[model samples]
Target: MQTIVYQIKDAVYANLTNRCPCACTFCLRAKGPGVYGSPPLWLEREPAQAEIDAALDAQDWTRYRELVFCGYGEPTERLDALLAAAARRKALDPALRVRVNTNGLSDLVNGRPTAALFVGKVDCISISLNTDDPDEYLALCRPKFGPAAFPALLRFAREAAQAVPEVVLTVVGEPVTDLAKQTRCRALAESLGATLRVRPFENGTRRFPVP
Candidate 1:
């Protein structure tokens, strides 16, 4: 069966699509068929809105602290559905927190200023800022947008900071992202009114930073 929604620690994750604009070298999908022992995340087809809702409704919300839009692909690739689901979840439980783990490429994918649409729907937006340099980003992520991806990502993060309550730019810790580079990434994130999170690296497993 398709794993539309699954639990990871204290959060419930929504897998909306299997399409993404970038093909990062370190993407977890390359490492395995799943993450942290969840079902295979490779979706045969994108879930319909109703299916997404059904999966979400089946969850015991009280057991999770947050609802996260994350999986094998970029959640913003299904921007409308993602926002709708988040809005509905908030309506169901006003106290529940919602977040989106993104590559900060939504504006490029959607072809417009998309951050403002997140207001009132999600509490946090986590963007992967793998490196502080644009050239390095091009080489590492190989985003379809090429060189334009890095600046656009920063722009999205800046705008998102104004719209979303919590905006975080993330980088892998240590070996992949050295201390000096992390410092630069932190400065860059702060310059855009966002904070930086260093995701811990494990030998054989991929881990995402908690919101």
Candidate 2:
């Protein structure tokens, strides 16, 4: 069976979908069956709320410090399901920190202000800011929304910063590490009231032991 919930380090991750609007060149899906030590994430169909609740309920919640909505595809692509599952998790333990790792194209995908949906349910929102330049972002992410995706992403990040407790914009270490570019990314993130995180490129070829 495909993995619905899996461990990565100390956090538990939920795989909600394989439907994504962007075709990122560095997407982990292209690297292997799953990231770290999880099983293949390609689901036969996106899990409904009941299945997600069961998968999460099966786990010893206290064993993980955080629960993240992330997998082979964009979690917000399954917005209703994501919200339902997150609400269930938060209801179980109000103190549990819940997060979503996304491409930040959710509003564009939904054609609405999706950040508002996360307000009280999520603790953190991590957005992929692949590059500071719009053109570079388009080239790297190749979003189906086209050039408009860049601006929409920025708007989403700004809005998310207000709706969620913590908002972070991230750049992959390998492709966007020039001193000037990093500086620009940090400044832009700061302008949006968000922090910039430089994520190291993990070798997705093997199943890493969970800590």
Candidate 3:
């Protein structure tokens, strides 16, 4: 019998930066990082590839159910480092399931389509669709730029739908309780052949524990 050894699934999270386009009303970091379970959200400098590699190396990848990319800020902002880590992890275990929890706004940030780059490397892409209504999205998201940032996020998800095998369009449970918006999000994701996952808003929730 081949014994399989797995490290407890590492529910690991990474903070790539403290910058984001949308300043959602529900953001825990809006006030500051240490406010909640997050100790401190401040990053003096973006760590180099070596630093990221070293951090990930210290982890027992086999123990975790999946490797997740998420933080107080947007993970895709560090596209180069992320891709390198993804490639390294995949090389180590092709069967490893790699996932990214993103706001899905990289295309707008990088001024180009960035989803295609995830092929083969990322096993799944879960993005925050947040709200179906552009106006409400703008209101809650409080994006740093113009109102256009709202739809751009949706478009990013749309583009990822065709690129990633398991694309998830997710929204938190709240003002989104509007049946119409829920229906719209579900229908749109279904039409695009992507899965729609509705997650509860993590507001004031206890720190996520490892399973």
Candidate 4:
């Protein structure tokens, strides 16, 4: 018998595509989306909006805590798909916790302000703010928008909270494991009314391995 084992807890991670705007070296998809334990998350193609909606239709929405828009890549890379799915989820239940995990490059990818799309549709947005410094951010995130990504990301986090109800920022929690960076990152989150999350990094476990 085959069972599903997911990395994310209590929530369903909607992997819309393997495509992304940033080329973070630490991304899991750099390898592939598969089950190390059970169930299987494999991306054959970027599913269409209709396909995504139908798939969700098969699930028990009430049992899940959140519907996370994430894959091996940036969820916002397929902005329309995300919006459509969110609309459907909200239609199912207005109080459903809808979230989008992004690299904070939707504006650059879409050629316009994109946060407004989340208004009343997305409840929480989690962005990858790997560093507080532009240089470090660029070096790590490799954003397609250049150094401007740092400020833009900060600004996006601010707007996301206002557009929806909650905004969140996350770091790898290992690469920038220092008090200075943590304080600055937390301060930025505070200023934006967003929650700051420090997810565990596996230097000896996952991020870096014997090579």
The numbered model that scores best in TM-score is 1
lDDT of 3: 0.69
Cα TM-score of candidate 4: 0.87
* Model 3 C-alpha lDDT per residue in residues 1-211, reported as the tens digit of each score: 1101112235555556666777767666655543325446467777677776777777776566577766656778888788888899789888778788787788877788898899888888887776677788777777776677867777777778778789998876554455677788899778767778777645454222110
Clashing pairs in 2: none
lDDT of each: 0.91, 0.86, 0.69, 0.73
Candidate 4 per-residue lDDT, tens place, 67-176, comes to: 87775567788899889888988898887788888887888778788898888888888888877778988887788788878888887888778898888888757564
Candidate 3, run of 10 with poorest lDDT: 1-10
TM-score-best of 2 and 3 = 2
- Cα error, candidate 1, residue 198 (Å): 0.7
Off-target runs (Cα >4 Å) in candidate 3 are 1-9, 31-39, 174-176, 201-211
lDDT of 4: 0.73
Q: On residues 1-211, what C-alpha lDDT tens digit does candidate 2 reach at each position?
A: 7689988778899998999999876676776777666788889888888999899999887788899999889989999999998998899899999999998999988889898899889999999887899998888879999999999999999999999999999876654366688899999999999999877654544212111
Question: What's each prediction's TM-score?
Answer: 0.96, 0.93, 0.84, 0.87
RMSD of each candidate relative to the true structure: 1.6, 2.8, 6.2, 3.9
Lowest lDDT block of 10, candidate 2: 202-211
Q: What's the lDDT of the predicted structure labeled candidate 1?
A: 0.91
